[model samples]
Target: MKVSMGVHQLKMEGPYLTALRESNDIREDAAALQARMEEDGYIFIRGFHDRNQVQQARSEILNQLHQSGRLAPDADPEAGLVGPDNKSAFLGGTNTDKPAFLELVNSPRVMNFFTNYLGGAAATYDYKWLRAIATGGSTDAHYDIVYMGRGTPNLYTLWTPVGDTPIEMGTLAILLGSHRWEHVRSTYGQMDVDRDRTEGSFSRDPLELIEKYGGRWATSDFEAGDAIFFGMFTMHSSTVNVTNRIRISCDTRYQLASEPVDGRWIGKKPRAHETALEAPLKTMAEAKKEWGLA
Candidate 1:
């Protein structure tokens, strides 16, 4: 199967890309789950959350978009049809404080899973990365550590699709086994998105990494309540949104409560990468050249 990722067309069955392996079978067994994560760099769970709750959260977000004139007036709010404005929205900061959004992220199901997975009490970052991606919008390839590696190396990211997300709608994709690429980790992962004042993404072209290094890109059609969890070093990105409807999803971080938290993502008001915006950013090409990755 051929799919679009960023600006490139990729063959899903060949050496380039493939479907993600689902780990729902071992979800209840922490030891098995941990072993799978350690080997594959991620775990994809089917129906990891309550479907109704996820749909409700999606409805609330769509209604907000409709009220702001971002959704087509003729369409039902739940449809999430983009209006003429067609602007993408990132609700990572204060906007995440909305009641429905908070409930979706802090649901007992997600909390309990993390607590068991981490082998103790688990706490999530207060700052959530909620996005409403419009047509043509997509994220580039990058490691989570570059953006949030200030403290615990054990921190993990849980990505939840707010609704049914087919390939055309642009969903998250992981570069299989990329977490074990020690060379890339020591060089690119060591750099900070905020401190380095760089573009953040390693590459807009997914094929670039595949050609340089060697790993299959894995993704799947995700339904509401489906979730994927990966550690800080996992390399991942999203496919392009080819559809008219918005692609809604959220990225939340988790770690053991006893571990030191990244100060940028916690507290009543997180000072998340605010200082980086003040300076002129360096292009990935420039940054990669400095890191000897080019």
Candidate 2:
């Protein structure tokens, strides 16, 4: 199959792109699930949640986005048509907590799955991400850790399909077994999204990554109940939305409750990267007067 990934139009018929291994049965076997997570760096579960319930949440979010003037008025809310010239609509850092969205993340199915899979209490970051990706655009390749590894490295991200997200609707793809790649982890994995050069993604071109490094990119057609879970360092990116409808999805982090979570992502109004930067820092000279530490 020919695919559009980043700047390249590459043929996927070769050994380059593969479908993720199925682990929905891991829902019943927690130990097996964690083992899979450790082995593959990701587990894509098809229909892990109830589709009807997921659709309800999808409707609520699309309704809100449409009300916010992000969706096309003439298109059905479920259709996810973007406003004229929207090009892209992202609410990753600035999206606030809402009753519908809050309910979606806090769904019993989600909590139950991780609570058991993690073998302990599970808590998610309050800063949930929602993206209304339009046609011709896709997420740049990056590891989750670069953005949120300040706390427990054990944290995992659950990428949920807000609605029925087919491949044409632009679902995500993971670079096969990236977490265990010592070089990528020791180098790119150690990089921070907030610090250093600050561009979190490793590369936008999938072919270039394979040519320089070496790992296949894997993805699948996603349904509303489908969920993909991966560790903080797992490298993943989205396929372009070839269809006209907006590709709606939400991704949030999960970890054992006892584990420390980054302070910026845990509150009602997440401060995110500018949490401290928005405020001017006190210079050493000024600090001498206040702290007597000069």
Top lDDT: which candidate number? 1
Model 2 residue 193 CA deviation in Å = 2.1
CA lDDT of each prediction against the hidden true structure: 0.89, 0.78
RMSDs, each prediction?
Answer: 1.3, 7.2
lDDT of 1 by residue, 55-140 (tens): 88898899888888888899898889988889999888745536787788798989999999999999999889999999999999
Query: Against the hidden reference, what TM-scores do the models get?
Result: 0.97, 0.88
Which 10-residue span in candidate 2 carries the lowest summed lDDT? 285-294
Worst 10 residues of 1 by lDDT: 93-102
Model 2 TM-score on a 0 to 1 scale: 0.88
What TM-score does model 1 achieve against the real structure? 0.97
Off by over 4 Å in 1: 94-97
lDDT of 1 at 76: 92
